[model samples]
Target: AQSVTQLDSQVPVFEEAPVELRCNYSSSVSVYLFWYVQYPNQGLQLLLKYLSGSTLVESINGFEAEFNKSQTSFHLRKPSVHISDTAEYFCAVSVNQAGTALIFGKGTTLSVSS
Candidate 1:
């Protein structure tokens, strides 16, 4: 079984500031890591993912995450945040096998203020 843990429930940062959302996961087998963002009253959208190949992956919106196998961590970071970045971010992990369900953490709310 795989489980995800988000260390912080809420992260408040001023606009243009850098922020990092800590996420850790535990699994007996290899897994895939992902970060999803949910806007107000909207469905979750994939921000970035670490499937294979590179240990580091990035999203189009300046968000990046690195997969650390030894530590079992995949922390999300943004060098510069905007007010529009305010939303709920979820860290999820799924087994590499097919038809596996994703196990998500509680979630971290990013509040970007001016």
Candidate 2:
């Protein structure tokens, strides 16, 4: 079984500032890590994922996450955030095999203020 934990419930940051959301996981077998963002009243959108090849993966919107196999961590970071980035972020993990369900974290609400 695999489980994800988001250390913070909420993160408040100013517009254009950098931010990092911590995520940790535990799994007996190899797994795939992912980051998803959900806008208000909208479904989750895949931000990034660590499938294979590289330990670090990045999204188009300035978000990046590195897969640390030893620590079982995949923390998300943004060099500069925007007001539009305010939303709920989730860290998820699933078995490397297909047809497995994703186990998500509680979620971290990112509030970007001016």
Candidate 3:
């Protein structure tokens, strides 16, 4: 079986500060890791993903995450976040290349303050 777990449900941070959101998974086989951000009522947008090869991956919007095999974790980090970065972040996993249905966690809300 494959499952994803997000350790934190919320992370409140002031604007321009660094942040980290923890994500862990349990899978019998290799899988794909993905981080998605949801702005308010909007749908989720892909923040980053780890497919193959490198254990580290980055997003265009300034977020990055490293895949840890032994820990079965993929935690997201950002050096500095803006108020606009406030959103609900979801961690997901897919078993194989099909990558069709993604198993999503409850979500971690990153509340960026001014």
Q: Candidates' TM-scores?
A: 0.98, 0.98, 0.96
Per-structure clash totals for the candidates: 0, 0, 0
Prediction 3 TM-score vs. true:
0.96
Model 3, residue 49: distance off in Å is 0.7
Ranking by lDDT: 1, 2, 3
Q: Model 3: residues >4 Å from true position, as ranges?
A: none
Ranking by TM-score: 1, 2, 3
Per-residue lDDT tens digits of candidate 2, residues 70-90?
A: 898999999999999999999
Backbone clashes counted, model 2 = 0
Q: State the lDDT at 108 in candidate 1.
A: 100
* Candidate lDDT (C-alpha), each: 0.97, 0.96, 0.93
lDDT of 1 by residue, 1-114 (tens): 789999999999999999999999999999989999999999999999999999999999899999999999999999999999999999999999898898999999999999
Better of 1 and 2 by TM-score: 1
Which tens-of-lDDT digit does each residue in 1-114 have in candidate 3?
788899999899999899999999999998999999999989989999999989989998899999999999999999999999999999999987563689998899999999
Using lDDT, give the best candidate's number: 1
Measured with C-alpha atoms, the lDDT of residue 92 in candidate 2 is 97
Cα RMSD for candidate 2? 0.6
